[model samples]
Target: MSMLIDLEHVTKLYGNVIGLNDVSLQLSSGVYGLLGPIGSGKTTLINLIMGQLRPSIGQVRIMGSNPSWSGAYLRRIGLCPATDVYLPNISGLDWVTNQICLYGIHRREAQRLAEQALALVKMETACRNPMGTYSLGMRQRCKLAQAIAHEPDLLILDEPFNGLDPVGRIEMTQFLRGWVKQGRSLIMASHILHEIEAVECSFLLLTGGRLLASGTLSEVRSLLREIPNQVRIRSPQYRLLASRLMGLDEVADLRVERELQQLLVSTDSPAQLARTVAKCVAEENIQVTEMRSEDDTLQSLFSLLMQLHRGER
Candidate 1:
């Protein structure tokens, strides 16, 4: 099957500084989150994909065409960069209309398309006002208007949530989700894990100029099973629960939190530990007020992967 994006033995450099180091990955046609901390080459990777910067070594294929030389392939992709382009003097409509005209479209036709784009992003009314007078959320909506005016098949976003309030963030997420439902592809880059999680897409994790991992949430979560897990259990009979858990071979460590009335269990086998806990709850009548896995969260998983990458574990 043809890949949406592909990189082989890719490395990017700025003098001695490595922008992306020996990274290789393939992405299919679907929504994907480009996840990383700041200065982790997320923007660099996006630039390479967008053909703004050619890789120092290795290949970059976007929609079966190498971005390095395939200028025509650009029209197939839409990008809303992380950098804020505040054209203080220009109206939102003019800015977006000008962007569409870059694809060799006539001014009148581009203007019409730009109108639709602005309307889609709920900024058509305020589009006539100078961008400088617009709020950060309004400006971001205008930027999105420009990017989508051409109606590209692949939508790529970098930090698309930077200047939005809670309501704006929800609206932006809903809009992107609607985009995917229309059978289009998307790649959204963000440092905030929950924002990507809100979009509910597979993700590619990058750090220190390296591609650490890529997969759907469940696929990635399965990796957690290979490593030990820390599960927190709170109960009325905390001491009895702790004693019962201590005898299990899978239980690697145990800690008691007197204030919380919780037993923290570190276990290599979470499944077995769960069975034991259930047995103790039913047969011994131990009251478990709360039983939760501390490491089950996406943020914790990302932290674990970061630790593994740094050779800390």
Candidate 2:
């Protein structure tokens, strides 16, 4: 299958400062989560995709065509920038409508689409309000409204839920979910791990302007199989469970936290251990309160990756 976006050994540099470093990526038509910190080249990659900045080296192809070569393909792509772009004193409706007009959409059609987009983000009632009067969350909705108004083939959003509250975030997530359910493509950049996990299991992690890893968390875990996996099992019969687990070849090390009534199990084969432990718990009817893999978290894995990248291991 052909990739919707392809980056071949791409690098972006602003003088001596590196924006991206020999990053190569291919994205098909699906939801992808871009994970990175503030200066990890997330925005630079987005800018390259949006054709706002040209790569210093290598090539970028969007929809099998060079994004910088023409504006035609941009019509099929929607982008919601992380930075603020609202024009004060203008009605939200007028702002989004004006954006649609840039695509040469007829005035009548643009207005209709704008209204529909605003409604999709649940901003129809406040569409006529001035941008200056809108809260941060409302402004975010306006940004989302502009992106989906055109119904582009691919939607790229950067830190899309920055200002949204919990309820607003849930609503926005549902909206994105429904959009992708229609077979359209989406790439979202967010610092929130759970939020990214909520929308997509696959991710591309970046750090220090370099690609750290790209795959599902489970797949990434497979890459660091040598690292001991930590599992914390809490139960009133913790000592019994620990004894059973220690007898298994799957358990490499075991520690008992008596005060916490938890047994920390270290295993080389976490996946297998998880399956075995789960089966044991169910079959034995153990009163296990919690069984979680601490080292399996994104933050922990990311930190380990960074350490490995820096030759700290």
Candidate 3:
């Protein structure tokens, strides 16, 4: 459980604009997701770790060494950039082989590794196609293959699912999950909450270049404990159901949306309230069609955190 990446009081500035401000965090070996909106310093943080940009203040350490350019610490790390800037004229196979060579592998070994990487990304059939001929999703897989060609201990991906369709996204998610099972570490930056939730073992949320929250999904939920949990109940007798739920001490608020034929119930304790409601249904002989929790999604969590931050400002 040693720290793979560590940042202490890390600050970055672009003249008058703040790229990152007094950010400090630690990452261990696992699939960690950096979640944030655009311009929230997600890219800046990744650049700092990659040694592409020096911090204005504080320190950045990757594998116990500073991550500045020429640090040599990057030898143990792999990077998949967010932008599509590959050599347009070169075929995917050639491009991957060239990058492996840059990592100091011999030509024959590099080619072998490149082919294996392509196969891992399911791109072996399309490996000889020129970069320009590949679709955005195909290009992303090619980039991922290149990043893993050297078999580095850690992999950093920025917007890895940026241009993928739904099926492609699912494939990418499954692939990353499998990669982490090999005991390697991965740090992925993404704006899509559902995608991050699917891939992330933990989360580091950023907003306006500042760290908002960091931890597992359950930990993040605890941070928003003040907010009531919501549930929707649908029954044949909506009015009767609403009246009974409203009488419970566990229920803090209730709203009946007549158009939807559902009753929205808010309670301070979701687990306890669910049990109470379940008992009430049995006692009342209510025919329940659907019962579900609302606003439990990661998107809702992010929205709530952003709103809280805005109110503080």
Candidate 4:
């Protein structure tokens, strides 16, 4: 399929500071998680895609054309920024309808679409409430309503899950999943990995003003197989298992965890270690109650990537 968005050796700088460096990526039609910590150039990349900021070097394309040419593609893209901005005097319905109307939608049609969008976000009851009186979560819903009210082909959201309670987050995640299931595209950026993980498995990893990696989580883990992983095994015969693991070159180190009942094995190849562990269990008749890895979390993966970047691993 054709690229929905593309950046080629894109570099953005603010005087002495680097916003993005040597970043090249292509996003097709699908939901994606733009994962990074704060100040990781996530906003800079989004702004570049939105044509709000011109890159210092290289190119950015959305829908096979430059996003800087706003009029040519304005109707095809929508953005929900992290910051909240609303006219305090206007009702939520009025705010969303006015936003839709700015895109040349008719007033009556805008209102109709706004109502539908609000209902989709489960904010129908508060649609008529004044913006100033709405809670933070309700205001967030209004922003989402405006973004999707026009039914843009690609929706770009910055910290979209912010201001939502746990239940609201779950509902919004499901709503986004359904939206993508219908073949529309979404790019959501968040500092919190699990929030995005709940909605999309594919990710764009960024840190220190540069693109680190971009692919499915499994693909990224595969690419970083050189990074040592710690696996916790709770076995009745912990000492015997440790001895067997120590004999293998794949196992780099070992440590006792949660007393002597559990052994944490460090290995360069987690997949290979898993296979070896299974073989050992079959041969030794070990009663292993549980097995898990500390490196499974996105944070740990990010740390490993950072370490690789720093030549520490």
Candidate 5:
């Protein structure tokens, strides 16, 4: 099979500021997640893949050809950028039709395809109304409609679930999942880890314009497992609980908050810790008023990964 995207020592700089720092990666066609925070070079990498910007140093190839060298290659790719296209005057149908026309399809065919795409996104009901009158979520669906109307081989989406409600988010996820089942390629950028986790794809983690890690979801998660995680439990028998937890292999450190009657544990094995806590509750009759994990969020994970990258771990 042909390579989908190949980047060799790719570095992008905007004057003195680095956009991407020596990112060398190769990806095959399927589905992928570009994960990072603000100013993490996620947009920079997407732009490079879309041929919107050429690399300042190194090489970028899409489908075995240089993207910047020819615009024709773009005909086979689709993009749904994070930014909104605020055309207050144009109706959603007209906007979508015009976007599809850019792929060289006739107006009639473009409109027909646009209608189908809109319907798929559940935007068919109010599609004839001006886009400016629609909500942010509606605009997102319209953007999605335009991107898929031409049925491009590779679809790249940035923050596709940004403005969606819970139900809308579910619909959007299902739509993308169906798109992947058709054997097409996809690259999606988002900071919400669980949403990407639900879709199940390889991940590229970026921070400060550097790619810290790239692998399948399980592989990346295993790296996270190496770091110490925190769990807080409130119990009246805090002293007894802390004493028992100190002996477990899973608990690396334990502290008791006397005033709050809470036990704070630092552990690498949260599942094992949970089991130990459950046993204590059943056999020892230790009452647990509350229990929660603190370091499970993506922000904490990213911060810890960055620290690991810098050899601070």
Candidate 6:
């Protein structure tokens, strides 16, 4: 697959503070999630890719061309900014049509594209309403419509799920998923772990303006190979089962909660660990009630990576 976006030793500075430092990455045609805390250079990376801000050092390339205000690279790149700023007096329909025209489409073609974009975002019903009268979610959809008005090859969204209701978030997720199915690529920067998980995209985790990790969820999981895998086991006879399971080599640590009749087990070999637990249950005549991998969740993984990166682990 061709590389859609590339950052080579990119660095950005805001006076004395660092926005990004020696960040290097290559993205292809798929949904990519940028995961980071606030001030971790997520927004800085987005701006750099969208040609809104130039890097202080190194290079940022979108579609093999440098991203700059005058580069015209944005013609093939759609951007939905984090901010909600819009033309308050214009209707959503007019705003999107004007943007399409700016992208060099004829009046008729622009109108058709604008309406299609609004419909794609499920904002056609409120398309005629003034931007000031639209709700936050509606405005968000409008912003998305404007970005896709030209049907760019790459879509860049910053905090797209912020302030959206549950329904809106779900709708947005489905829309993004469908968008990528059409062979277009997306790079979304968001703080919400569940949102990133729902998108099921590769992740680029950043911290303190540095790239902490970048890969698929499972690939990132491999980075913390030394970190113990946490699992919760519930059995009919918890104490007896916990005692037997604790003796296995795969099981490194165990904490039995007598009140809840559950055992929180940390293990090194997740596959062997499961087999060992199964053997214990079979041999000891223990009735298993529940078993779940607790630490494999996206939030837990992010927490672990951030903690390790900060030297807090």
User: How do the residues 1-313 of candidate 6 rate in per-residue lDDT, one tens digit apiece?
Assistant: 9888899999999999999999998887888899887778999988888787899999888878876735677788888989986677999999889888987789899999999999999998999988889888888998899998898888999999876888999999999988888878888898766678787789999877888888896786575554568889998799888778767888889998888889999887667777877887778778889988887455555667878778998
Error (Å) of candidate 1 at residue 199 is 2.2
Better of 2 and 5 by lDDT: 5
Off by over 4 Å in 2: 220-299, 309-313
The better-scoring model by TM-score among 4 and 5 is 5
Let me know the TM-score candidate 1 reaches against the reference structure: 0.77
The lDDT values for all models are: 0.88, 0.87, 0.85, 0.86, 0.90, 0.84
Global CA lDDT of candidate 2, please?
Answer: 0.87
Candidate 1 clash figure, as a count: 0
Task: Name the candidate, 3 or 6, with the larger TM-score value.
Answer: 3
Ranking by TM-score: 5, 3, 4, 1, 2, 6
Least accurate 10 contiguous residues by lDDT in model 3: 295-304
User: What TM-score, over all chains together, does every model reach?
Assistant: 0.77, 0.77, 0.79, 0.78, 0.90, 0.75
Winner by TM-score between candidate 3 and candidate 2: 3
lDDT of 5 by residue, 123-222 (tens): 9999999988999999999999988989999999999999999999999999999999999999999887887887879998988888888889998777
Question: Considering only N, C-alpha and C atoms within 3 Å, which residue pairs clash in candidate 6?
Answer: none
Superposed Cα deviation of residue 114, candidate 4 (Å): 0.6
Q: What CA RMSD would you report for each candidate?
A: 4.1, 4.0, 3.8, 4.0, 2.4, 4.3
Model 4: residues with Cα > 4 Å off, grouped in runs: 221-297, 309-312
**What tens-digit string does per-residue lDDT give for candidate 2 at 163-252?**
899999999899989988898889999766667877854789987788898888667647556555888999998887877787798898
Q: Candidate 1 has which clashing residue pairs, if any?
A: none
Candidate 4 scores a C-alpha RMSD against the true structure in Å of 4.0
User: Residue 153 in candidate 6 has what lDDT?
Assistant: 88
- For candidate 4, write residues 5-108 as lDDT tens digits: 89999999999999999899988888888988889999999999888898899999888778776556768888899998767889999989999999988999
Best prediction by TM-score:
5
Number of colliding residue pairs in model 2: 0
Backbone clash tally (model 4) = 0
Q: TM-score of predicted model 3?
A: 0.79
Error of 2 at 214 (Å): 0.9
